[model samples]
Target: MAYPYDSLLPQVTRPRTISPLPPSAPGEEAKDEEVEQVKWKRPAVVTPQAVHSKRALLEKEQEQTASSEMPRPSQGELFPAREQEEQHRQQVEEPEENGQNIKAEPQAELPEAQSDIMALKRKNKDDMRRVQEENLNQQRGDQQNQVSERVAATPLMKHPLPSCLLTNKDHVQAELQDSEASNKVREKRLEEEIKIIRDKANRLSQSLQKQVAIKKINLQGLQRKQLTVNEIMIMKRNRSPSVVNYLDSYLLGEELWLVLEYMDGGALSDVISETFLSEEQMAAISRECLRGLDFLHSNHIIHRDVKSDNILLRTDGSVKLADFGLSTQLTPEQNRRCTLAGTPWWMAPEVVTGQPYGPKVDIWSFGIVGIEMVEREPPYCNQSPASAQRLIATVGTPKLRHPKLLSALLRDFLSCCLQKDEEERWSAMELLQHPFVTSAKPASILSQLINSVKKRKKN
Candidate 1:
């Protein structure tokens, strides 16, 4: 069958045929045919140049076959409708010049097929462009995800604090804590020291308050009274440790101010009322009272008002005789006083009976003070002054409420002081030597009792 493009192929010429030889022998004919076939199949002698030419021709043919088989652009891409029409016009015009009249056929299906192929090529180009772009975007997304994972895996790369700086900061914090603790300790110590100093200052103020006291007396009432003058003179003349010292006296208009040593423990009466004393403590007090009475009697002075109220005490337990307003001096010629000038309860029986008495009256009063210490009050304390004076004159001696409770030595000492006969009563000097008085503890021991009373009162 003839194709439409057959005219484009090269023309091949036919080879000449030889006439057959007449009537060859039947066997010889077969031999002659084989020889002819052999001669026809025999290879021709080939030179180097011919061999090279044949090799080059074979390579050329191979190249032509490859080019024909390879894919090519569609006819629509190679030639548009205008180019196809121009080619057709040239074929028609050149046909008579080539000495042959050839008719050109219109290819109706070629253009339609070329158009469909061109449409498919454009679609493929768009699809390939889209695929390339999508692949590139996917690769970029994968690279970004890998970078994020690396960053998350190693946190030290993001924010790092050096070990040296951290250690130094810890050291500084510890030092600050220690310094604050030390400062607190020092502040506490200073507060304690300040408290101690404040206590000492308070104690010194109290001590100063107890050093001196003033007594005010109206001068108009006692200006001409010899008793007041004698009392002041006697106080000034006495210089015993067991006696209160007189400082100075002042005359302010109608008032006379007598400055005297202040006893911080107040009066012995106050001490007995507030608390009970042991026998040893009472003995110590008796010794001090005896010392004062001895001093007074040795000086020829009679303390007619000797009683617990007239006895003063210091915080150190020193006892002294005070309030010498009822005291009088005795001469060798007149050694007795008949005047009734003492507390009824503590008055001597001879004085209350209107008999003459002397310094031994003070010894009798001291014995009553000893009873006051034990019983908290003297005998006949509930009676009136007149009734007590009557009792003292009628009764030979005042008896204790519970005399059996007293020790033998204490009872003997009281007996010596309370003897009805003035000659039988022991003097203050003789009483000082009594076992009850001699066994007395030191005066310093009484400070404990004084301080306890003060603390209890404060509470």
Candidate 2:
């Protein structure tokens, strides 16, 4: 039978209830009329609680059906829904808390991080500034050191002491004044010492000059005094009043020193050069020279170089024959000397021609000395030595430059001395007896001429 509100209610699927018919007769067909009828259930009343309960019951029944249909999970594999829900909630809540903490932590530490960055920047700036300052200090120190070294190396006069030693101005000024005063004193002392030294040096130079002049005079004297051993022996052997006296002889090292009589009037050549000789003066000189020659010839010693230069005079007018360096002894075995020697102007023709000659060669030179007295120089005085030799060799007799000025007696005497042939030439003994020599005044009168020459030289 159907209910009245069944159409208004939701349809619910339910199992049908049917009463079984009496066991059907074996092999007998069941008739419709014999079957139990299906009973219709009545609809339940609808309420909020009932509806909720029914939905719950339906969900529960669906779960039971699904549970029954699927295989059951093991206990270890099973997770409770409540526990999963709690875990999910905790995960979500933890993320939210961590996100908040992350945001809050950054916000809270922002100022401190900024402060730390500022501190690091400050430290970097401080370090850079310190390094720059150190570099600047080093540069300043180097510059100061360079300046100090320069000051030290420079001269004291160039770089004076700094006056700014004291902070007080007055003190610095006083100290500078004192230093300047001391420097002035020192400079003055040094200048005085220098002046003294200069004066001493000047005196020393003058003394040295005087010593040199004396040495030069001695050297000239020594030059005239130089004598060979043969000459010295000859001199020692023949010490006549007319010949220069050799007082002593000494050998000093390689040089031979002879102390001879000093002739204050100097050589006859000096007198001839200074003044014109009168015939009488010439005669006197000739007589003295002839005497010396005669003495030398008698001793068998030939005075080869017989010139006015070899004739020296004293202040007392004592004439003597000097400089016997060329004198040679004539032995009886070799009575003639063939050596070509003697001054070219006065050289004999035979001597010039390399012919054997004797003491007559001295007479020829004495004749030339006489010519020197008359003419102030011999014939060919202007010619060179070679040219003079050539003229002497070629010319028979040398002509006097002023023949007219000479007396006949003087000319005759000169001709006798200057003969071309050595054999024809008058001997020194014969010449000493000639009127020209015999007529000569005393040798004491020659001092007047010497004094006059000295006066002229002084003027």
State which candidate has the highest lDDT: 1
Best candidate (score: TM-score): 1
* Count of backbone clashes, every candidate in sequence: 0, 0
Tens digit of per-residue lDDT, candidate 2, span 74-133: 332586765554433222221223324212112222233235555565665566666678
lDDT of 1: 0.77
Give per-residue CA lDDT, model 1, range 98-175, as digits (tens): 544334343333344335555565665566666678878999999999999998897775765699988999999999
What are the models' TM-scores? Answer: 0.53, 0.51
Alpha-carbon RMSD to native, per candidate:
37.5, 37.2
TM-score of 1: 0.53
Worst 10 residues of 2 by lDDT: 210-219
Residue 7 of model 2 has an lDDT of 49
lDDT of each candidate versus the true structure: 0.77, 0.73
List ranges where model 1 is wrong by over 4 Å. 1-210, 222-224
Q: How accurate is candidate 2 locally (lDDT)?
A: 0.73
